[model samples]
Target: MTDVLRASKFSEWKEDFNWDTCLTGREKYGNFLVSILTSETNGHVINLNGAWGTGKTELLKRLYVSIAKKQHPVIYINAWESDFINDPLSVICAEFLNQLGYLLANSRPKKELVDINEALNKLMGSISKVAYIFKLSSLGYKAVTGDATLNEEFDFSQTLLDLTTQQNSSSMSLENYNKSIISSMLGNQIDLVEGMKEIRIQITSISHILCDIYGCNSPIIILVDELDRCRPDYAIKTLEVIKHFFDVDGCNFLIASDTESLQESIKCIYGQGFDSERYLRRFFNQKIALKKPSLYNYLLKKGIDFDGMCPNMTLTPYSNDNERKIKLLSEMLNNDKFELRDIERFIQKLTACIGYISKFNVKNAKFINFCVLAYGIYEHEKNVNIFKERTNKMSSHGIHCNGYISNGMSVSNFITIHFKMVTLANSSKRYNLDGGWGSCSYQTEMLTVESQDLQTRDWRREDLIECERLIQNYRNAPNSFLLWEDYQKLIGLTDAIE
Candidate 1:
């Protein structure tokens, strides 16, 4: 047995949401999102917007699972994955078809599935046409801007030839053929701006067939996750494709992203001073921020575990023990550099360090737990070993951090004096620190010490004061619980630790 807390409790834990717990605090918000999807409408584009790691993806997933009973077919597309592909149309086609296959899995008759497959292939041809138009437009852009190193005139001619040859099986010329279809969709004028209309018709056809095949009258709900983490072009283009092409009457889109970053991305692509938020607003009719979670309750519910401790101590709240710990945790976390995820990290570290305490005192569990978390928050998790190693160093090399000299000021005295205050605090006891161990705090009557408590076999009169000073400082400043690297930093040593 390793006598150490299993690090897996917090580090490897994921926030798993089920129907009952998913709506615990967010019942209204969950209902609001599902209501929008289930509302009588042709379709919708809803953005679940928030800062990075504010649980936007997690929120969307909850919505995804919760909406199942709403009778809507859902598809989750990780739009950040668009980075791997260069062509926008190909990216959309791949994500949509991959998820569509799953949604329609074994739902249709064999003959109908064959027919649906043929219809899907034709829809893919329309997608290929979309890719072709994009390629042509890129060449046109290079020619217009004179930004191409290659000869644009030659490239354009070669591209046109390739297009014509590829479609020569048809009677009409390639340009006339595409224009004829576009003109039909637009009723006369073919503004490439209205290119959306042609693709919209094709996508609508696909959605209808998909609905019949998936056996759902409700709209197909497509949840796009991790949009903000994608590159600027990919993120913007994916949104555009969904709006213009995939905005069919029977399909809905729920996109999750850091809306601010998406706005910043628009600014980056469209140039400074452009209203990126306005551009985003045009795409998303409704936006909801992910609900913020309470850090204290979240940690408490995690049920902090310590394997090397006495029974009945892991996060079992005593007489206001949780409150005391929460108060200190709040103070330490006042600086927002540590997000919810970061706080969970320190809580895990605290549980692990508490496992290493020798002669564990169940009475002082509250105070010790506070120091464990405080030390972890202020320093690295590996620094938990510093207490042991620092004591060993003091016993061997006579290095005292108390800024004083004393005979028989052994490591045991230092360890004893420090944990004593913890014992006193948990037990509602105090003693004088004016001339006692003042390492953790500078208050008189800070901790109680009895005659029997003072072990002088390897201690001295001066050692008592020095050890008290050491413990007081540690009590006052959790940063004093320093690892070896911190020591090297204090001494300006650049050499790596062995």
Candidate 2:
């Protein structure tokens, strides 16, 4: 294909840049689901939790893409944007029916509804078992009474109709029904909803036949993202309904949420007295914490050739191609016929001027003029005295930046030292130059030194103070366990992995 190099404002932020692609295959999260799908153990539900912008969605998306391509039917739904305002069971039922309707519309028109509903009911039964295992399943319990044995005569419709039609339906009967039928039989035991549960049960009973329409091998996996956005009651109730109904029937569920929110949501449904840890343990078997990469490793990974780059180059490149582009710019500026050594010498002097003036209350315009004059010597044939004259003019202006050091002792000498040190400390590989990283002491002292207007104090003192505390705390208290823990968390994220 011919190279197309069009440029426009709209294209600037477009995904076509392919910034997110990687050259090699990185680690995948497929192992987490392997056991859930293959083992004879009870079906699994997992919550992939993390902070916003931390790559939870991306990881889930990739995992879904991989698993689904193998012919396992995967359905993705972002609950954060869904309009599921009804009972949790109703939402699941609606989704199942919608999917089943699509699956069976052409093939089995006659038995479509019946097959689907029967499958749904069986699946719901499995969900009830899971709920019972989890505890706090629901309020209803079943028992035998007049007319017939409870299992034989106590079906959902009759019980719901009996509850609604008989004006004298005792709360005791409702309570018993909850214990025997609702608790033992149905998964999302919402039967206590002021006739709302009964209503849901009736609807679920009628619509559940959709599950049978799906082929036996065609199990569906529904992925729900951003449960963290739901109200606690809504979020927890939704989770329970999913566990009891959907998860029970051989359908798989993957939830993307904030762990804290999911915990709080469960608390709301099962009551604050519920053991939050145990409740969470039921759904999430393992947790993967995610965070941003450390600055030091991040910069090094960009493959910066720091020693070849100018110390004053503020527009740092994030990739190798950008670094080449910058090197080209550097070479263009050098071709003005200034000796390469002279250019380096002038930058040394300029850095000194910047340090001195930055400490004082010099006008920005004057600073700019000084920089222009410093660089003007390259093109124009200015003698050494003129350079000295311009340099002396700033002394009375309160910039003590006039002295030229013997290579190692001046404030100007330390400007590059300081920049390189900070860069290396953040994410660069190592100190870029030879001589054993000797500039570190000078850099540290320079960093601590107060400038004329105390600009350093205003800009960086609080941050320095925090750093000092961290150092002191690290020294006096415990081990570096917390630091290592945090480091591990940073790498397990999609942002870092991608």
Candidate 3:
């Protein structure tokens, strides 16, 4: 078998990977930042929700890199890893402080701030070894005139007085040249150890000093990725933290998550009252849903240039219309001459064949396999639904057995068991087949079909066995509402046997 060429995560693929690759989406993200990163809009949470494997993380990475390249100090963190099912707020705060320290270490501030930093450093060095102290108190007092308040002339003097006289670090204030210099360097800082509201105010104030007011305009963007990978609760809390802490002036935050997965999680955790749909719509200000490009397009963009990998196949423009080609392919797959069962069988065969063909270094073959698998599953589901609608009884799709029948089962029966197994399989590996057929192990049981919606028709005898165990396990338990419902649905099983 010829080896398939792997897609690049960097360099050649970078163009297709970055914000510029999706120009329209980039603009939308920028627009979201402009609307929310304002003085008054400090704690606005925004979610960048999309389906799983839809490149949300890729977008966030590129945006983070772009903002940093443009000279905005940026911090990218994966909340999923950091929070670990704990309160995300504390995690975010820790991350914020970590980034702040990094920024301070890399402070190549503007010329004015540079000068102030040096002067303050010299003055502060004479006083103490503490990390956060400015020693401009005596000099600041001398610089002030009586016409102005004494405190106004001396910045550090006020802080020193507060520390010594009031015996309280909280009483320390910024009032003189020290205040102006410190403010000039780091913006208006009432205090750092305060609550969320104060932190946002500080961020906004520093933003003014760094860009708007100070003329050194650079964008500060924060990218939070892998949110969907987190446990459902962590993911939700991460969203809340973004809303509370980072959505304000001079700072932009972008979050990426799997929308469907997240929605399901939210529904499960918060129940129906949360209005999962509305909540999602509001959170993800700029959601970009990416459908994996068609096989043809994917291959065409991969380029014909072969580096280390062999270019075993190629695509050329066909004289025939594209729609005509697609239609012909569809006809071949959906030929009416074939029996309904044959069509289903053909799909299984085609999926296996296509999967094998995808190993080649050609886009078309790879795409054909992808399309075939996707559409095959889609078509199979449709067929199952149609059958259900017409017959009213959920007939088994394929024939499979729990090996209980001494006489053996037919092919259709075998396939039906397989289909049902796939459809009703739960987290545990165990399942049950109809009748006496069930899993090899009696201890491990599967959730009943009544508990969850089925995705496919092929189920095994293991499915039924698993479901039986699950029903029994939850029997008489205090929190067995869902299981009870499933049990109730299975109470009258006369139809399934027929």
RMSD after Cα superposition, model 1:
14.3
Model 3, residue 11: displacement in angstroms? 12
Model 1 scores a C-alpha lDDT of 0.51
lDDT leader: 1
Per-candidate TM-scores read 0.56, 0.39, 0.43
The deviation in Å at residue 439 for candidate 1 is 20
Which residues of candidate 3, in runs, are more than 4 Å off?
1-45, 99-103, 114-194, 212-219, 280-296, 304-498
**Clashes per candidate (backbone, < 3 Å):** 26, 23, 34
Model 2 per-residue lDDT tens digits across residues 1-100: 0011111111232232222431112123344553354231234566766655445565555555444334344445556544346455545544443333
Q: Which ten residues in a row have the lowest lDDT in candidate 3?
A: 1-10
Q: What is the lDDT of residue 470 in candidate 3?
A: 37
Better candidate by lDDT, 2 or 3? 3
lDDT for each candidate structure: 0.51, 0.38, 0.41
lDDT per residue as tens, model 3, 1-498: 000111111223345545555522444554444334332223334566555544556556565544444445455677766654365654554444344334433333444443444333333321221112223222232243122322242232233232233232322343353344434434444432333565455555545544532233344556688877788777877776677666666666667666767787888898956778778676555554433333233222333221112223211111123342232223333322333334334434433433333344222321121222223333333353532332112333422122222123332333332233223333333322232233433343343343334432344344344434434434433142222222222222212321
Worst 10 residues of 2 by lDDT: 1-10
Model with the higher TM-score, candidate 1 or 2: 1
Model 1 lDDT per residue over 1-498, tens place: 110111111112224643455422565777788888767348688888767656666666666665554546566677775565655555555444444433443233324444555444444445445434434444443454354522232232232233234334432234566655545443545565566665676555555654554445467777888988888988888888888777777778888887988888878888989999888998987887775665555555554433334343332112224544554354445343455555655555454445533244422332232332343234432333443343212223221222111353433344334334332222233434332322333333333342123544555544355445445544665443332323223222211211
lDDT of 2 at 80: 58
Lowest summed lDDT across 10 adjacent residues in model 1 is found at: 1-10
**Model 1 lDDT, residue 251, Cα:** 79
